[model samples]
Target: MVAAYRFKPVVVVLLLALLLLASLLSLALGPVAIPLDDTLRVLLQRMTAAELPADQVLIIEQIRMPRTLMGLLVGATLALTGAAMQGLFRNPLADPGLIGVSSGAALGAALVIVLGGTLLAQLPTAVLPYVTVMGAFLGGVATTWLVYRLGQSVQGTSVASMLLAGIAIAAISGAVIGLLSYLADDAMLRTLTFWNMGTLGGASYERVAVLALCCALVWWRLPRQASALNALLLGESEARHLGVDVERVKRELVLLTALGVGACVAVAGLIGFVGLVVPHLVRLLLGADHRRVLPASMLLGAGLLLLADVVARLVVSPAELPIGIITAVLGAPFFLALLLRAQRRGGV
Candidate 1:
């Protein structure tokens, strides 16, 4: 038991090291290159003395830091949400955006972007991301509520009905987004399209900091819920017999899922498959115990997103592809492989 317990922290540390390596690589990457040596010196100098040459400091502070932080935060949040969703619904297939939360967030962002400067101009410039973030959060929460209500009968939450409702809501919201797109001008359309594709190019420290804090909160709290979720695997009645509060656990997981998903969608703009991919990947490697699974997913997710972002930067050179595109391209093949393996094993 002790050896088993020790394994998770060991794996977490290894994954964190890998994520750190990828983040350093991200700093080295761009249209104008900063050599690894100077990048390290710049990063170290800023950390040690908070002072450096203007150009070096600017590259490290103004440019690379925010982008790297955003990638980490968004990555961590996506993975955490995936873990929470799986726990809540008791299905490996469960995901945050799988229930229309992502579509709802995207719709909210589309509305803001389509409205032009006039819509959000009154807000202070410093708070624009926060405004958009709030809109996305509310949108996700609203959609989740709708899904729950529509899916619930006297039978409580039915996964099938919830999924069907999500599909229905997503379809309607997507059509609305299309209608808005049709009316968009060239610049607005370009902006909306790019945003939908997802990039962290416009990251700011303030936004990254906010997202980091949110992800941190979820990571800290969610892992503690693992034993309870593990108990849930035995069926609700059995879990309740084991002194687990089934409804309370469900409620908490749902709330935590919303918070984590909201923070990620707010910043990352609906990057799919991380939630689907990471938790399952970790489960395959670490076992289904959420204790090990959650932390492993967080680390793996961060590494995967950083690697994807790196590929996005290099894939087209001077023109960066959206990170979402890279993730989807990479993840679709992996998803298919997993599907086939599950079929062979008779697990699905």
Candidate 2:
């Protein structure tokens, strides 16, 4: 296929190398500024049973490491989810945030946080996390299904309809969130405020482990659909004629995207644009083929977020900014540029 010509081995290698470099730099360039050599030494020290200075070991082991890893997981997950969502919808503009999936997840999470006291008081602390996450996942699935349905009729999926539905869903979701905020007391309101802002400041070993597991599951599942997604781009009827299971593919992509994204949102709140922008960039540079788009988007997405997280930390210095702000600053310009370019080319 002409599309697969750009899938160079070197591109994947370079992306991976960049991701590794960003991860290490993230570990080194924090407020305390752990040296690269010391960072390596401490990481190996823990793995190889060697001794290092107590404070340095603590910094690498406890603080920067978890945060860096969390950034990687969150970035990769959002990108993967984004790529899959775009492919499923056959629109480069599709994204978890743009299509109201994140809003739904946020609504679910907000409900959990605001009502946990009265409604969920009897639930065990251990199950509370899963409850919120499941709520968010269900919300994503529901919104995605609704959007997909609305976007489809006797004809193919209508990008315009999907976009409009997303706007309506976002408006309704925001109204619901505002209602939840109104009902919330000061403490719950504060929690909701932070969740809305979105940060990775709470990263820890335990959370990273869960994020890793969910991300791994998504990575495993998404690539398997690459060929099917390729067939899908030919249109649902054509794909079905070619023996592709259109319904199954849609269901799988929706659920998998929702599951991974919901977990990430449940953990890190709503971080936007990574999904919308990264996949388009991947397709632009590499190819439109889902085989290339999906994996590259994941890697580049991780690298982009890590770079953003780094900027988020360094821009405000010791008083680190929330990552969502950093992404907005970066993504907004790129988005506008994309739109302008598409407009110049007679519009997307």
- The top-ranked prediction according to lDDT is 2
Clashes of each: 0, 0
User: Model 2, residue 340: what's the lDDT?
Assistant: 85
Model 1 residue 315 CA deviation in Å: 1.2
For model 1, the superposed segments whose C-alpha errors exceed 4 Å read 1-10, 46-54, 115-117, 341-348
Task: Score every model by TM-score.
Answer: 0.89, 0.93
Task: After superposing candidate 2 on the true structure, give the runs of residues whose Cα lies further than 4 Å from its correct spot.
Answer: 1-7, 47-51, 119-124
- Pairs of residues at least 3 apart in sequence or in different chains that clash in candidate 1: none
lDDT of 1: 0.78
CA lDDT scores, all candidates in order: 0.78, 0.83
